[model samples]
Target chain A: MIDYDALLNTASTMGLRMLESGAEAYRVEDSLQRLCRAYGADSCEIFAIPSLLIVSLCDPEGHSHTRVRRLYRRGTNLWQVDQLNSLCRAVCQGTPPFPEVDGSLARLAEAKGYSPLLQLAGFAFVAAFFTLLFKGTAADALCSLVAGAVIFFAKYPMERHRANSFFVNGACSFLAALTAIAGVRLGVGQNLDKIIIGAFMGLVPGVAITNFMRDVLEGDLFAGITKLTESLLTATALALGAGIALSLLGGAA
Target chain B: MMEIFTGLLLPCFYAVMACVAFCLVLNHHGKLMVVSSLGGGVGWAACLLCAFTGSDIVQYFAGAVAVAAYAEVMARLMKAPATGFLVVGILPFVPGGGIYYTMEYCLSGDTELFLTTGIHTFGVAGAVAVGILLVSSITRLLREGRAPKNRHLGGEK
Candidate 1:
């Protein structure tokens, strides 16, 4: 007597998790279908978009179920994808009872992030090293570090309030630009161009752009175009934020 | 000779460190971070190779091919999403700097520099896409013949 509710829950939840963790739409569809099959379900079908996921499963006994989830927050956390990947392995070995699957997902959903301090440092190092890669001087890396810290730490409070993506990124890039320009104005870095470019790395649409590329190539044309436009706008917001500072600074000096 | 060696070595080193940091920021754990760093290093190494000898287009395409191929291999070995590796692995060639420089020129009203760099930037971006497409297409081809059905690259079945 396969518990259809449990099956539906697990299948849809896994799809949702994959979608939220920045997977391509086709991958999301494929994983959900496979997971359902592994669970003794006859079929699972998924229609995944950047903003919504719809899944339908038919159990071996010919029972059918459907779930539609409207996604509110889409983020990129590869860790979640890795966790789900392992969970699938466990299920295939012996279809875990629903509770075990449920427990693993709960833990995964609530997995603790690395400390704020460490992530802030990670941001700083990313900016600094990339500056060095771009042939910026040591002083430019130092300036990038400072600017990175400003942008990275500033994101916490902005996210706490659950602000809009464009506004949050726009505002943070604004801060990033101001900090880098100030560093240059104070003789902390030699090249404003290099420093600002390095500082902007943290805000670049890495996940979006990568996923969009994968999506387009994977034949998810609609999803690919959607993500492509979004990534482009995100890049635009970043440039806009930094542009304001540059424009103002240029006007001043 | 020494200058060329250092020129290549330093960028690769920074790329490795930067990829690790990028992974850490995205919350990748233990072995995944190391593997991703190696992948990024390979991609950056390819980029440097392109810079030294190849045309602008092929170099960009080659770097992307390196990234996509490495990410595909690593994902198969690790049972993780190739996207995880692809996202960070391709960072070395991402057009962040191009975007910034384009905007800078636009703002400064330097139409000449803006158009030239903008076209180049767009070309590099396309080259990266072609790289990912070529490798992913290969992976899909390899996965399609055997492997039962529809289970390739992170399906984990």
Candidate 2:
């Protein structure tokens, strides 16, 4: 006999994982429904927004089970999304047993991303190259590189403590602008605007904006609005932080 | 020649590097990193190639279409979700600079420039979104046409 309870648990867990990793709302809803149906669910209904997921399904015996997951933390971990996508595809195709599905999900969750040092390097390269793209001089790129490193190191701990995203972005951009201004003051960089813009790219809501469009296009109006708000708030935070820094230290430079 | 190199080639090269860096930040691993970063290059190149249109909004739109189409094809080949490619590829076209300038104008008390820049920023963002919408909609239609059985159900109203 199919274990409907275990099936519900696994399906909901997968959905939660995908949502946390920033899968588009439609993808999350579609995946959950597909998984439940693959396991012989007679009917499945999934409601997903950026901040919550509700999944309900009925077994052949007419018993209904529902799982509600309140999501407080959302991040763009595309690797996790890709891993879960493949796992979902495999399970649906092979009709995998419950134990196997549970184990795979556990393993995938524990998978590590790049190490801290590498992530730091990633931050630096992103800042530096974007400066060049914006027509900053070589010295400005170097300054933005240092500013990016500062932003990463400064923001990492607050993020670890689960600080409010807006405050974190604001504080990071404040630091970025401060660094850029100091770089100009010290004669290490030219073009203050270019340096700050490069540093800001690290904090920009590019992923949020991209996902926002996709979500809206997929007809997930609620999720789309949530993402749009997130992107807007993030941009505001960055600007506020940078604006304060520029006003304070900008005069000295 | 200098214009071609600086205006066209250099930005695309920077786009590739920046995207690879972004892949690392987002924890995208394996050969997918390089493949997806190439999409960023394709996007910026498309943007530059369309420069004759004399409108930044149109440039962003062209770039988004190229990136979306590339992401779709690559997702099929790699058996991975297209989100990774789409997110990273479109980064070059995102209005990070526009946002900065808009905020800058607001902070500096240039309401006139602020309004214009902010509206232009929104226009650019809308163009990118519509371009993505257009391509993905067509791809979905073609996919459903080929495989009616695979059409998604139960989610839409």
Candidate 3:
């Protein structure tokens, strides 16, 4: 017989995964409720935000099991979110055994991210294309491609060390801005604004802003406010990074 | 020289490339990446069309609504969370440029440009929020309206 604690753990695990994978708070709550109901729990309650998730389950006997997880890191991984979405759908359809759901959740968490080389290439293309989209000349795109590669390489080490988001974003943007400025100074690119805007694409917190709006629209007011503040912080870090470099460049010239 | 063809096509191509790349960065892969690219392309095309009118806020609001509406429909058809597409679709006009320019002006001590850019940046950001909220409310209403019908149809069994 599967222990009640084990089943609650499984349900809460699913909720935690959804939360960490950037699902909205209400979605996480709904998934937890469904998973618990499918598995025979009388009641389930979940409070999920970007930073922390609280889940509790109650049996008919009035005994309850609760779990709290602190999400020290939060970022989008649509692949994980997609898989969890499928898992919850399955759970809602049938009460899969705890072990099966556990295996799936583990697999989802262990899913591989894009390779570093591919990520670098992706960053380069994103920066270059953003320059083109901004109406920069081909020369500007070429310059941004190189700067993007540098920023990607710099970002890898910081992320590897699990650095803070603000510091990582600030440093990455500074490196990108400085690289673009240096290139323009060398006559390799024209217009610092285009270059700065181009390389700034990746660090812009697009996902945060998008998720923030979605959360608010979904009536997850606390989650919305928290994510909005977080987005603002990220934008500030990005700007500070680029601004510092531009001012330094100005001073030196 | 209007160069209408290049002007029309370049942003779409760039939007597609940037969307795919940003998806990779966000760890979104598989066929949905292509869907995201298409969504991004169309949303960007809409924004670019509005941009010709020289109204930044309008384009952003319209672009965001277009993107969110697309994401909502696609999510229903694909049985996927709207986020997987919404996050990438509006990449072309997410105010990254405005934020950068605002900061640059601030740091360089250009008070006039800084204020203008800063206000414009916040305005565009609000426009995006407004657009998404508008579409999301509609989708929510649609879903809630359908729930009763599904229950009446005895699908709950």
Summarize candidate 2's per-residue lDDT along A1-253 as a digit string, tens digits: 6777798889888999999998999889878777877877757788999899998877677888888889999888989999999899889889878999999999999989889898888888889999999899999999999999999998889899999999999999999889999999999998988998898888889889888888887778899999999998998899889889877764334
Q: Write the per-residue lDDT of candidate 3 for residues B114-135, one digit (tens) a residue.
A: 9999999999999988898899
Q: How would the candidate models be sorted by lDDT, starting from the highest? A: 2, 3, 1
Model 3 TM-score? 0.94
Say which candidate scores most in TM-score. Answer: 2
**What are the candidates' individual DockQ scores?**
0.53, 0.65, 0.50
Candidate 2, chain A: TM-score against the reference: 0.97
Flag regions of model 2 displaced more than 4 Å. Answer: A251-253, B1-3, B146-156
Task: List model 1 lDDT by residue over B8-92, tens digit each.
Answer: 8778899889888887678877898789887888998898787756577788789899999999999999888888889888887
lDDT-wise, the better of 2 and 3 is 2
**Candidate 1 global CA lDDT score:** 0.82
Candidates by DockQ, descending order: 2, 1, 3
lDDT of 1 by residue, A153-213 (tens): 7887887888888988888888888988888888888888778788788778877777887
